[model samples]
Target chain A: MSVTYAAVQWNRQKKLYDSVIAGGVALYLGRFVGVGAMVHPQATAETLLIRGLGTAAFLLLHVVLSIGPLTRLDRRFLPLLYNRRHLGVTMFTLALGHGVFSLVQFHALGDVPPLVSLLTAPARFEQLGLAALTILFLMAATSHDFWLKLLTPPGWKRLHMLVYLAYALLVAHVSLGALQSERNPLFVGVVLTGACVVLGLHVAAWGAGRGYVEVCEVERIGENRAVLLKLGDEKIAVFRHGGKVSAISNVCAHQGGPLSEGKIVDGCVTCPWHGYQYLPETGASPPPFTEKVAVYETKVEGGKVLVSRCAKTSSI
Target chain B: MQWAEGLTTMLGVYGAAGAVFAALFLWKGVAHVDAGARGAGIGFRAVIAAGCVALWPLLAAKWVRR
Candidate 1:
């Protein structure tokens, strides 16, 4: 949102967000490593480091992925959406630590070069882990808004969708790599449950609003204001602007900000998250900006607003 | 080891070329696009160029498109 960026735009809210993140990591690591030591007294420091960081990173990834759908389902989670890049960068650091220590512990000190051994590793899970790490590195490297501005919002969002691919690879990495040899059934259950929860939350969020549904009264949608209506599994912003109602995807193109919560300013629907603006009718941003969101078909019937599942444009 | 060594050497060469390509991209290429990175200062651009060096293929594709 700036011509030039600071190292970080820190504020009181960000301080609180980062504090919660750091504290959560510390607590999760302490419990995991402490319990691991008690369960396997013979485990080495390298083993503990690998497991602890891996678990922490995986858990954080789940939370990061869930935040998007969670905010769509309920706007209370919007604050978490504001600084999700920090969460992603932190998760990448943890995953990188896990990867490095794992390579040192298992791949190094062998006849072959560590890099070669890692690449040529016969282990199926190891290959998946490497693929996941590559995606994570790409995501972390471009987490800055500079990339978003350069790539354009749509391109940037498409590239960031690789996170889902990374998640799938990491799931394989865990189930095949760690769970295969895990003695504790509790650890296995925890890993499976984590995967299931992520999948279930996404599916549930996707199914929230789909078909034609009555949203709210036309009078309720005040001028220059928006009313969020659920359809299938997504939220749509039903806007009342210039004496007409237009519906667009509630998720902002830039970082999935809640557009329903945003106010129409200067004849454009302004996103509350990063101030990215879009035309209420077409969902396209003002000229010189190419960002857009899915526009839904809306028709008023008997003083009630109804939205169709079919998008106005195939591309949002 | 031999395969890894050869690949590393190739990447090292490519990395050097990528640095130059990224600089050219930032200076000449980005200026043309209306939505491209116009306001990014030298320091930020350098970091992006370094990223291009490490991830040459992806950045090169994006740079070409831009």
Candidate 2:
């Protein structure tokens, strides 16, 4: 939709999204600080900041990760996907705060630079935390549309998938670091439950689309739109364009966006996720770009369109 | 403990270097693919470049596939 670049594309939805994020962060911090002070009156300010920010960021990350599979499971979660960048940036900021405070508290007095200290620290989980922080930094920096436009949707999405790795690293970070020293079973339980929920949701969402080779009439697939067909674990998009019918992988070659939701643009099937386009006939991008999606064979039988259960490579 | 410690340190060193390389690749790869992308301001492009760096592996995979 954005053909031109702007410094900042502000809108009502973005304003509301940012406000809710800010309010949620403030409320989370207040509650965390209040509870921490009560449980351990002797805890210092630095400890409180580290604990609060780290935990909050971890929780936010769980939410951020959940949004994808949740949306796949139910379309109601699409609203969260629209402004997910803000959620990510806010989470990264909280993580940065935690990293900075931890550095100052534990490594500032040391002779080595904080970066060096962080790398060489004797702590077991420092590396994991550092890795997670680095990934978050990349995600935050490229959260803008400018990057998306340049990176192309597929490239940008591929890059953002590093979030899964970052999440794993962070779980290890907590497990090896604070979780190790903290004796409270409740805290451990919460961490475990969070990881379980994230993992469980992903598993369920993935399974939801499996086990069905849905058959739909070609006539039912409206012009310029796609019908999403699930063939076991694979989701295929059957499109009818200009009196021709073709089927392609529902997964956007970039970022795994639902190609079924995308419309045909300029004779190519466009991905709604980031506007990457592929030819409906061959599932290949137009000349000069090498992006391609798996193409499926479709046959007409008795005045009905039948999409194949497996993908057949189209010669483009 | 010794083996674990060594493995962790090795991952840290490699991971740091990998991050830098990935970011650089994303920046260049995106610009290469999209002609209009290079027209953007340097600051904004640099940010995108960092994202590429962060996701170098995925970008690399897609780049080779293309």
Candidate 3:
């Protein structure tokens, strides 16, 4: 979408999204710390802060994990997908804060150094927490488009997929660390509910059938709009424009964004995430840009649109 | 315990080297490799510095290749 890459392509919607995130985090942390201090007067400020941040981060992760399936299940959730990275980076920041506070509180001031102490900690939960934090740090660091360019979409996607592993580690970390120590049945119920929601939504979305043999009728696709089809493992975007239909890979060349969510603009399919464009017929960006996506063969039979299982590159 | 100590030492050295590499990369090397970084502002460079520190080895290879 941009000839030059900036730190972030800030827009009105992004600013609003970030503002809401900041306000929500502030409110959550304030309420959590305040209520904890009032209830547990013996708890130190650092302890309350650590608990608040850790809980906030865990809750945010649930929201982040839920956004993908929610968007797939209903297009109305697409707005949440646009600013999901901001939520992720925010979650990582809070987790980092929690980790730093815990390290300083527990590991520091001992004869052993903090890093070594953390690594050699007797508890398996500590090790799991450290591993999860390290993965989160890597993900937050490489969340930029610069890294996305360096690591191609597939590679970048694979790396980000490590978030699921991080989530698993954090779940084990919390279960072993907090659940073992706390007798609160509410904590157990909350963790179980969060995990089940995340898992359940993903299963439901998968069962919603992204892959369809017959996508839909040609008339079902609005002009300049696309209907997403997953044939086998390949996701294809079938676009209708000017009385003709064309199909291309649903994955955007930039950041692996869902191109099916984008609309045709200026005779080119414009990616909804960052507005990256590709010609519908050729699946190639216009001159001066060298991005290309796989074009799929689509046929209209009996007014139904059927996309090919195989992919092919087309001449521009 | 020994592996943990070894890891700590390796990470210390890597962190030291990465800090130095990140400073230089943010100062002069960034513009040479990414055309988009040319004439970019301090905010952009500052934001990228975090990744630069973590990924200094890869960036160093890229810098050398460039």
lDDT of each: 0.82, 0.80, 0.89
Per-prediction TM-score to the true structure, in the order listed: 0.73, 0.67, 0.78
Which residue segments of model 1 deviate by more than 4 Å?
A212-294, A299-305, A308-316, B1-9, B15-50, B56-66
Best of the candidates, DockQ: 3
Better of 2 and 3 by DockQ: 3
Q: Candidate 2 docking category?
A: incorrect
Task: Indicate the worst ten consecutive residues by lDDT in candidate 1 chain A.
Answer: A1-10
Candidate 1 vs candidate 2: the DockQ winner is 1
Positional deviation of A207 in candidate 1, in angstroms? Answer: 1.5
lDDT (tens digit, per residue) of candidate 2 on B7-59: 65775776687677766654565445544455555555555555555555666
Q: Model 1's lDDT to the true fold?
A: 0.82
lDDT of 1 by residue, A215-269 (tens): 8899999899999987656789999888688899999998999999999999999
Stretches of candidate 2 off by over 4 Å are A211-213, A216-246, A249-281, A285-316, B1-66
- Per-residue lDDT of model 3, residues A80-110, tens digit only: 9998889999999999999999999999989
Candidates, DockQ:
0.25, 0.19, 0.60
